[model samples]
Target: MHQHDRKIRTIGLADVSEPGDEALITPEVSAALATATDIVGYAPYVTRVQPRDGLTLHPSDNRVELQRAGEALRLAAEGRHVVVVSSGDPGVFAMASAVFEALEDAPQWQDLSIRVLPGVTAMLAAAASAGAPLGHDFCAINLSDNLKPWPLIEKRLRLAAEADFAIAMYNPRSASRPDGFARTLEILKEAGCGERIVIFARAVSTPDQRIETVELRDARPDMADMRTLVIVGNSATRRVGRWVYAPRQVR
Candidate 1:
């Protein structure tokens, strides 16, 4: 393991709800972190998933946070193995983009050995547990207006509803983001039929996990939070007891 010491390793995003939830980290990522001593990951909770705590690397002038991430990148570039970690899938709305963006701004890190590992995104894990709600064409949209505007997100929702595609919604709700959920439901209702299925997956892969199915008209905003992953089914979606399935191979 020490032979790989000088390499720069980025651990995949993982849900930290519990040891069981750690399955969000893929096998390749597990191997990458096996020998890493210095690991930086997105804080487990949505409340802590910000740029201040090294959980994510993003455009910020916060002196303290910038200094810390700069040092980490510097160390890795200087031949010290450092891990940049994220929660859920880094490729999704996670830290990979931030890390690379920061590195791009600092050309000194261009020469460093950079590797991004893959992890199970919360939506996938949640969908798996609730049968296969994403067995067909699906779209993922983040409702956070921090980087992108609410109008753009709403437009995307309208398009998804119009296509009648299975949808995976991220950052559905947060303390600061109260209206995105309601707006999403309204748009979906306008574009799609009331018979559409909606699946709410909260605290996925953790002991406190909850999954439920509701009609498009009945989906509520109150039950959602940052940790929740919502899956909206097309007209063909069906629910049977605790399971929701989308027919893939209809003969």
Candidate 2:
């Protein structure tokens, strides 16, 4: 038997918990790292994986998800066990979908074995730190217009507001697109969400973490950056002893 055929080169997608929070690493993810021949991902996430003698880390710039996914697939095809790392759960606004998208475009990669090991997503972590503001009905929306159109985002935001769902926003503001979040806040105000509670959870689970809650009317675009997770509570969301939560009952 060929040496390559003797070992299976399955590609593993590993998710890491927020920075400075080692306790959140799942057992499965920790186990997978022991066998990873190569780890691929954005620089920040890839840096989280400890360097070992046999492991090779390939860190790339942000916004190159497709290229990164393709590189991981190619490495796996070469009989190397590879892990594509993401900050949160791989499936939630992360590398899992990008890898699948790359696979779809390259039918030759369809047979490659791939597994997504889940982790605690950012919103959930943020919600937990804020005392369950998402206890009631809620929806998560990516506010980045890089892939989707702005009108579609606006439409969804308006509809979500109309439905009275708590809105968990990802990629709310970045240096490149500072104005988008400002517009988002304006739209929410127009939707009569001004008095609602808004939480900006920045760098959650990290040493520099900061969680701030304010009324939507008082929220400013400057309060959030790319690293922040912005959560807008529904009509009934309230604060109790420095924590915000949505009461289970209506009326």
Candidate 3:
């Protein structure tokens, strides 16, 4: 039989995981790490995995998801156990789609087994830290326009505001995209959300974690960055004593 004819036994697995304290790492993730022959992820996330003699770690720079996914697929095709890691949920603006996209171009690998392990995503953690600001209807938007156009993001922001859904925005601000979040704040205020609450959860679940709450009117663009998770409450979100929450029933 030729080299390609052998039926592969091992598979590639993708997990949504953040670089954080060991205590925050889920047990299932730990187990997957133990069995993985190769771990591929962004540099910081790959660094988080404790190095073992048998495990090979492939770390790459940001914005190289397709290449990373292809590498993982290749390793798995060789019958090596692989784990493609991502911060937060892989399905939420992360590596899951990239892997599938890579697989589409390489039809021979389609039969290879793949599993996705869920992690505690940032939006869920951010909402919890802010006392359930997402308890009611909410929508998450990635404010980074790297892949999509700015006009699309703007349109979605308008629709979200009109629907009065709590907005959880990822990649709200970055050095290269300084003005995007500023425009986002302006749009919300223009939509009459000045009285609504906004929560900024930065480096959530890590030692550098910081969470801040303020009114939408008072939210400044400088308060957010790549590490921050920005959550804007709906029209009816309110504060009870010291906690900010979205009431279960929307009026």
The lDDT values for all models are: 0.71, 0.85, 0.81
Q: What lDDT tens digits, residue by residue, belong to model 3 across residues 1-251?
A: 34433222221222222445465456777787887788898888887778998999999999999998988889888878887877766678888889899989999989887777676677887787778898999999999999999999999999999999999999999889999999999998998889989998987776688888999899999999878999999988888876789999865
CA RMSD of all predictions: 5.2, 2.7, 3.5
Best by lDDT: 2
For candidate 3, give the lDDT of residue 196: 88
Number of the top TM-score candidate: 2
Pairs that collide, model 2: none
* Residue-by-residue lDDT tens digits, candidate 1, 102-192: 7778986676667777777778888897999999888999888888988999899888877767999888898888988988888888886
Question: What would you estimate as the lDDT of candidate 3?
Answer: 0.81
- Put down candidate 2 lDDT per residue, 216-237, tens digits, no spaces: 9999999999789999999999
Return whichever of 1 and 3 wins on TM-score.
3
Q: Considering TM-score, where higher is better, how would the candidates rank from best to worst? A: 2, 3, 1
TM-scores of the models, in the order given: 0.84, 0.92, 0.91
State residue 162's C-alpha deviation in candidate 3, in Å: 0.6
Which pairs of residues have clashing backbones in candidate 3? Answer: none
